[model samples]
Target: MAMDTPFDEFLKEWSDNIDKVRTGAGLLSKIRDADVDVGTTPKTLIERRDKVELFRYDPIAERSVDTPVLIVYGLIGRYTMADLQPDRSLVRSLLAKGIDLWLIDWGQPGRGERWLTIDDYVDDYIDEAVERICAETGHEKITLLGICEGGVFTTCYAALHPRRVKNLVLTITPIDFHADVDDPALHRGFLNVWIRSLEASDIDLMVDALGVIPGEFMSSVFSLMTPMRSIAKYNVDLIDTVDDRDKLMNFLRMEKWLADRPDHPGSAGRQWLHDLYQENKLIKGEFALSGRKVDLGAVKMPILNVFALDDHIVPPNCSKALGQKAGSKDYTEIPLPGGHVGLFVSSRSQGGLTKNIADWLTARDG
Candidate 1:
């Protein structure tokens, strides 16, 4: 083929630019029309109180489980992201797979509850919720699926009651926060340099005023870790998929989840940063919550460590390393190709993470 003239090249470039602009405009239109689903799986809020709310996801077809699975979400985002939409929800997929679900919804905390700690959130709230689940399900043991920071809580829960947790699953969890001190993803060593000043400045005051950690603040932190990717990558993609409704809905649902900020209780937020991130206490087994020391070695339940290859928040090493430290004979790790958030939303991971979860649970009826 003969090479095109410079004028022809200029025309092609102009046409591509126009297409991008049109695509972006169409995307914004669809985004505004779509119904954002920040609500979680089909469940009713059975329990609600200050800084804590519990939900029950009714089994799709009469649950056959001798044990119920409770999903613990991270402090960063709302729980419903797992069940973003009916079609693309992790909770919905689990329901279809016959895994009875229970979710912990820590609704926006109030000023009165601003002093809550990880100890309070995990021990007073989560521990009580676990008991409630046991009473409701009539099962002495329950399966735990903890994602991100929630996994840290679940680890403590399992350690406290080794026999109570039949099977334990940790997804995109950062047990070894100190893994890569120099790696920007974990922010283990370097983050501390800024935390003291940030906490002493407007950021701390901002949380104090709001009573919980703001989603916007957390999002900004995530952005700083990967400035170009978080800031520019999405806008560029938005311009290319304006007319694709399904793609647009996916984008909007995610954007909604991203914006639906959850404020972290001040006390809990401070302890988390100081103890876990700054001191790296979890991996060293020096962490204590609820007046008792937490040891990962005590987590002897059958463990499944699921991690995403591209997870910037909780790197693969952070999650995959759980299996080795838990000292569980039946420990397993499932590595999928996606990021921290993508693990819940990515199409490719849906089949693998979803099916594997059911099979893994059913296979181990401890």
Candidate 2:
């Protein structure tokens, strides 16, 4: 009844091609492992045997900029997204640009770490990391570049201890959770639906079963936001790019990073949902990490608020309004023409945004 001849031929060819690609990927992984061990650096292999489990990627090595910088990644994903590739990595770019960069890796959380709270992370852990970097570098203050929820955390830190911050770079960061309901991404119901479901079901049991939050579950959230492209269309396009060596390698790397989700500590995740989302306390200046109140208006250092114009996670009005709230005399705004993730990943952004940040660092260093 159907066109069996052409369909059957196509199916057979597709299966053969899949097998070939599988073999090729296996070889590529081997060559990649053999040629370069990117993780085997002096700055990496962090000693996290203490009370907290963390990793570091010091791109500057021994040398450092006059203005030191520490990058804080978001909560949901691993820090590798910033260093997704050997070629266009943000760490590599900043290092080449002569900015001393120290990246903190909040390692995958185990079941034991489920009770870790926001107060524990920011006041105790991140503060200790900051002190260590400062003590080692001999700089009283360090530039902090925080992305996504990391930006939110950095904001709190800056407000709490203004004297220890040199420059603050907040990117695609959501501050004003009390956004208009029309904005589907910012609407409470949007996140609440999935978040509530996770809580209602034995998601804790699922998490315990998986040990860490499964990448597939995290990936499903991103897919659900754009059901058409992520679920079906992306794989269709991957078929065409399979022939391009460089593109395929980049694809694989991005996919690998995207598949790797950070295990959000139960306490921290619960706090995020309650204080940040439902209560909307962060922007209201009602949030307190410890005894100190988190008031963004207390941030006195020079601020560079970077936001993607098209970012769905952090809307334009929300991210752009930081310049008004921040107490910095030298405040700037840069709205990149990309999505939340694309602000760092887009080829066009790498060309301009990286240089702009480098130039800013250079100008202020002296």
Candidate 3:
């Protein structure tokens, strides 16, 4: 072989870049053609109601704890993110750690379901699911792990029926809507700021216009919060992962989840915006669901309040208040490095988040 000249080396670099471009284009084509599979975790549907289902994942490991952990995802999004894939799945990680896992899938809602309120979710749907899980597992008390908006519902459930929940894990759950009023973070949560500007009449008109809050509308609002994210994700980010088929597929899986948001009931949505977001009633113990008030002090179970250090949607201030309000003497606050969604599926957080949850539950499961 002859010694390579500078010009030849430059040509080789250009050729490699061309190959990378080809790979990126091929991955993009696969996405456009719908040739990818998303949310492929194997599970068995144990219970079903009108628009909700309780799913129990098949054990990933031989060993498991007796106290089952019930996972309640927010009504705004699907629970598929918990089990995005085998390698990066929170459900799989928990199951492998010998922790029994159960999840709730609040199926898509219709206009008729607009009357469903926070009370119905906490009292009827969530309470019934907890009962079924307890009945099936032969356990008197189960652990509750709530994500985002579901964290608020779980907090209410645990407060209302403290005897049923043995341990509570809240990840990126917003307790104080005004937590970030003075935060310097550019994305200090547009939801918090926007809600402050709306009046009762404004909320009523918006709710009346759409009997049930449209998932698409909510998606658009989040999109607007990070206008450049979509562009960078499809272009720069996709190009970086395109060469790695697994990474490319994982990116697509996340996108698929984001695209599959669920509609929120109009009445519940109105209450969430006006009471919790606008008035910050949950923390003040003034928020009522069905006919009962939610007292955070009643959350006396062994508590693990986790928040993303750089979370934009739910700021650190929003989630950080859980530890102070909850009555549990065993409360622990974990401010991990990641954004709101990153805490779930990002590699940087997937391990720490799941491990912290498993370890905390193990200590308190008895």
Candidate 4:
């Protein structure tokens, strides 16, 4: 056995520094010319209403499931995350499995849409989209696949119109908002605690004054949940990924997605922060839309609840709570290893996540 001399150690350090500099320079050059545009999978615009547009992905493989799946993403972020890139796309993965896919794009909402509320989104937009999908496919019902906040929208929809949804799939969705209190870990449910700390009047005042909640403001709040990581992402993490082309591309694509946050409408934002986050209305069966109470017990359709094991934004307990509350007899909860966004984009989760969804829907396609 031998040990390195001081001179040898110094030479090794010098070589490492040179490699770092070379990698950093190459990263900067790639940033200057990198094509980081996302959501490139081919799809057709099927319908449009106000700022909401519904798209149906062009089939890449033979259809196996008779019922189509409608993906609904929340207003805070675009649906681009689902189809970020060809290699790391949830949309493409499901499509490759012969599943018919459709998605609802809640377009960039400005002051004009500030009047919209949860009722308009669930009752009007989602309902209409479901109807359109059913009519187009000549099927009586279609699957509702919701992501994050969009999962709540779909859950509300399925509860309100059970017969319209053949199956419900929720990923990184929070059913019991206050379930984070059970864990009480600092990394988990910071959003819930922050929102609960504010008064209802505070939410009203902000929405009334701003008309729409700025996307950047929400993004900053999310950053506060994992402050250290947010800081390191641009510095240490970026440097670490620079040496690998695929990893660097993934990093840039994520940065591009993070930068494209959309402003949330005032009324809906108010209900979300106050009614759901603060009051815990949805889990309590008190959340209502269009003068109708949203009862989780009314969610009679088969449900596949997918939660991330290490999700900090929406805690595992919060999502797992759905298994006990939902009205479905065949409810299944699958916990994957990753954060909220990683459930959709991480290579580790890509296989299990897609297979679980495709397989679940296929079995229930009766």
TM-score per candidate, chains pooled: 0.88, 0.81, 0.92, 0.95
Cα displacement (angstroms), candidate 1, residue 81, comes to: 1.9
Stretches of candidate 1 exceeding 4 Å from the true structure: 1-3, 6-10, 16-34, 61-65, 182-211
Tens-digit lDDT string for candidate 2 (1-366): 343798888888888679757765665565453343222333554446344544445554344357778888866887776776666667777777767777777777766777777787777777877887788778899899898888888888889877788888887787876553445544323443455344523654654455445546667877776667675645666665665566666666666677677667776766676677666687788988877779888998888888777766567766766776777899888877877677777787766667777777777785
After the best TM-score superposition of candidate 4, give how far the Cα of residue 83 lies from its true spot, in angstroms.
1.3
Sorted by TM-score, highest first, which candidate order results?
Answer: 4, 3, 1, 2
* Weakest 10 consecutive residues of candidate 2 by summed lDDT: 33-42
Clashing pairs in 1: 27-242, 212-263, 212-264, 213-263, 213-264
Candidate whose lDDT is highest = 4
For candidate 3, list the clashing residue pairs, or say none: none
* Candidate 4 TM-score, true structure as reference: 0.95
Name the candidate, 1 or 4, with the larger lDDT value. 4
lDDT of 3 by residue, 145-208 (tens): 9999999999999999998999889999999898888788877778788778878898788779
Q: For model 1, where is the 10-residue window of minimal lDDT?
A: 187-196
Scored by TM-score, the top model is 4
| Global Cα RMSD, each model | 3.3, 5.1, 2.8, 2.0
Cα lDDT over the full model 1: 0.77
Selected candidate, larger TM-score, 2 vs 4 = 4
Question: For candidate 1, lDDT tens digit of each residue in 257-279?
Answer: 87777777777887777777767
The TM-score that candidate 2 achieves is 0.81
